[model samples]
Target: MHHGAYPRSISNLPLLRSTVAPKRPIAHSPKSPPSTCRHYRQIPEEEYRRRLAEARPLLSNRRAKTLETIGTTKQHRTFILLCVAAAVVFYFANSQKVPVTGRRRFNFLSEDWLTIFGVSGDAYEQELRREGVRFAPKYDWRYARVMGVMQRLVPVSGQADKDWKVHVILDDGAANAFVTPDGHVFVFSGIINLCGNIDSLATVLGHEIAHNVATHSAERLSAAIIANLTSGSLFLLLGLLPGLTLAGLWTLTGGRYVQSLIYDLPMNRKQETEADYIGLMMMAEACYDPRHSIGFWERMKVVQSQSRGYEVPEMLSTHPSDGSRIEKLTQWLPEAMEKWQASDCHGGQGAIARQFRDALSHRRFMGVAWYIAVPGDWRLSIP
Candidate 1:
């Protein structure tokens, strides 16, 4: 991944992941009293540009050797060949294999490799989630309902249930949500503030899920390797085929490189749109109120506009602006809403809230009051 500035022209963007996941930098600050430090002189824009030009040569010269290592722009053509020759030799050299959706993933990543790339990460993350605050009661119900929807959808996606687990993280201040390649989900509490109801949340989840479903994580990692080994003239690496390295694959999903990829790398916009469409369809199938997606987005637009002079919106942090998203979502609303209503059969937007309210009425009375309210005699008896 290129350690560089965010590109104004995305083609030059780095294939790195985001450092801003679930966290954002404060956008507005009081103009610091003119910097009193000796090195704080403000240069004119023209002078700044001139200084940048002046520095470019020296910077380029310093970076000459490292640039040579990046190889060539079309990483796949040559690097893949080089890596493939190495991979084939490495493949038969060992009987290792990797698994996914219960099928063999990489012929080279066998039982030993799986054990090497084992549950350490998952166990640590589990501890982190447990140490985190528990979400409010209603949040649990929403999570269960959403997970149920994904449970139904993943099979439709042809993903194996035993192999892929669904997860939720309940951070109230977090406006973002993401799913790891292994199906661990992190949903921030701040997200609830941005979205109106289940459908909207579903839209967000669906987008992240789409990234995993499309194997975008894996592909992006390959792209990174290609981009990194940019100038290799090894034609044998071409058509070397998709081989997953246990270590490299995990790094792509879990490490800083992915942070660079999500935020800094030039994303395939078509994939983004495709995820929206597929996620929309999945939400509708789950009997959610798809129209809430519109309301939820409108709220985001409002929040973003208000934040303009104060803070940057989360949508812009990883996604396109609200105006374009709203328009695109609206374009597909008719078809999605039609399917949603049929699956719903009860009504629209209000129906989800009503269902949630009813669940609360039942659970509080049953799970709470029954367990806690009338236990005096029983408690005394037990004692």
Candidate 2:
């Protein structure tokens, strides 16, 4: 109580000893922590129990719901992935390689179906013939010449079932020619007039035939079917709204249209380029000058320029532009020349055929009578 000594007042009355100041409570340093844990320790047991009782059910329910949501999401993702895998397998299985170019393509549509659509049915060609003005006396020498060219090309094309035939639609104004999927060739007389030489005509013929040989039409049809089905299924799977509103409907349709334009059009343009390459080879093998392909496309460029509104940009159009076609042909000319020189038929025949075609194109005959009236030597002649 005083100086390091116990008070003697323990024996005496305790109040009688000198009064001692209560020891001051120790001051806390700034760096030292306060006894915060004491506040929690001071809480009553009954209150702690009550709080735990209130929180347990909520925590358990949240945990259960989170686990359930994760399970459901995994299930949905698994199903969507399985659907995509199946579609991929089906596509790979159905694809086939195109001849000459060896490009893999879809062809679920059968040749029988194509024949029914183009060959057996009187709808496509017959309807076209009926609607448009055609050159009469269909057996004219010009047609014969076209048919002759077809005969040469078909043998060289190496198509196993060669049922190729040419129908000369002598529409003097329509400068186009095309081959159907079923081997029906339509040659507009306008093209005949436009072709500067027989080789140029053969170039056009070979190109059209190459389109059929490559089976581009069937590929396009198959792609359209797959694209429609796939896009529809994807939107359905997504649960995207396809409602009465214009915006909803557009959302449903717009994706598919953009998808087709992005995927389909480029593929179509590639098919055109493939056909050009094969056609150049075919013409060369048939003893037609592949170099004249340049000339033909040069002529087409002139025609395309004159018919400005009729043309579309190469990126948008199915066919490559004339300049592109000519450039490609020029690039392949050396290879084509090798094939031409190796051919059994001499290229000189092209020159003579050009002369004969030039002369015959000038003559205007209304019927087969005039066709016969043409010199017999000229009809049978070959250089």
Candidate 3:
């Protein structure tokens, strides 16, 4: 408010300031002109080296631990050696000879164990009843037809003393027949229709019976156990390698598929072939014409072609090809014919003998005798 002279309070007041600031010129040192580098606290060389040395051991320990987690070379070698030794011991311990074929194979299941826990015929029959599956009555023609052939084959099956029971299942969709080790035979209606005659039916029945006689089910179970162990071991071994895991191995290896292709399928095919051989011999010894087997297999081949529309390669299939079966049957026909001729089938009190007598009696008493035009064909005759 005062220009030159003012009031006492006004003269003692603080000075008024302007809003704008005045500019100043910058100065630079000659030796280090306008330094822009960041400043840091300096450390002593000895202290830094000591700290680095201490950290090296920690880093080394971490690296060693990671290596241990993935398994070292020595550990892997030791584990693999142990696996080989265990496998060798297991193989030798379970080695046994197959009946009839005399082929040595691995099966660790004992007879007592098989009896108690194995597939039981009586139990299976009860299960079928529970499931409401119908069985052909004993008085039915199919039942009699199956029984007649089975009776003739049983005496020569090497287990005649066993309480053998045959049931004809009313399933027309399943062209299959199977027998339990305890002498229970199940014949499907579809297979009966497929057989077309008793001799061909005998071929099918003899094959199924041979499976029981050979104890293939128990062998298959044992093989499954071995396969599981092998697969688990393989997965574990693969996971121990660097950058691998069980899930990864499963995805990459297709473990179950590999095991089936390598072990299970081949084993099944082998068992099937052996059963074919044994069944052929058994049918021949029972005085059923063995040559019918070849024709039956040819018919089976045609059926399979129509149903599946495409054939699976022999390597991938559980059973051998129909061609393979026919070839083997043809090769074995000479021996089968010799056995048939030696049976003296015309004079015995066997099922075939009874059938012959019935035929003759029908001709004499009824003045009419039905005969199958085909040599190996089956036909019913009443006396």
**Maximum-lDDT candidate:** 3
For candidate 3, lDDT tens digit of each residue in 246-271? Answer: 64666587966776778777877787
Candidate 1 lDDT over residue span 7-120, tens digit each: 111111112222323454577686779766676678999999988887746547557654543433466445555665564444344321221212122122112222233333
TM for every model, in the order presented, reads 0.47, 0.64, 0.64
Give me the runs in candidate 2 sitting further than 4 Å from their true place.
Answer: 1-81, 96-99, 102-104, 116-121, 240-248, 251-257, 309-311, 346-383
Question: Residue 9 of model 2: what lDDT?
Answer: 12
Better of 2 and 3 by lDDT: 3
Model 3 misplaced regions, further than 4 Å: 1-84, 97-102, 115-117, 233-244, 251-253, 344-383
Q: On residues 1-383, what C-alpha lDDT tens digit does candidate 2 reach at each position? A: 11111111100012111233446656645676666764345768999898888775645777766544541365654676676666666676566556555666765554444554333323445765565535435458778778778767765554425355566765665577766665666677777888857898898888887766555666666676666556555544543233123336656779645654577667767777887888898899888889888888888788767756455777766567777888988898999999889888732233312332233222211211122122222121121
Candidate 1, which ten residues in sequence have the lowest lDDT sum?
374-383
The predictions' CA RMSDs to the true structure, in order, are 17.9, 34.8, 32.4
Between which residue pairs do clashes occur in model 2? Answer: none
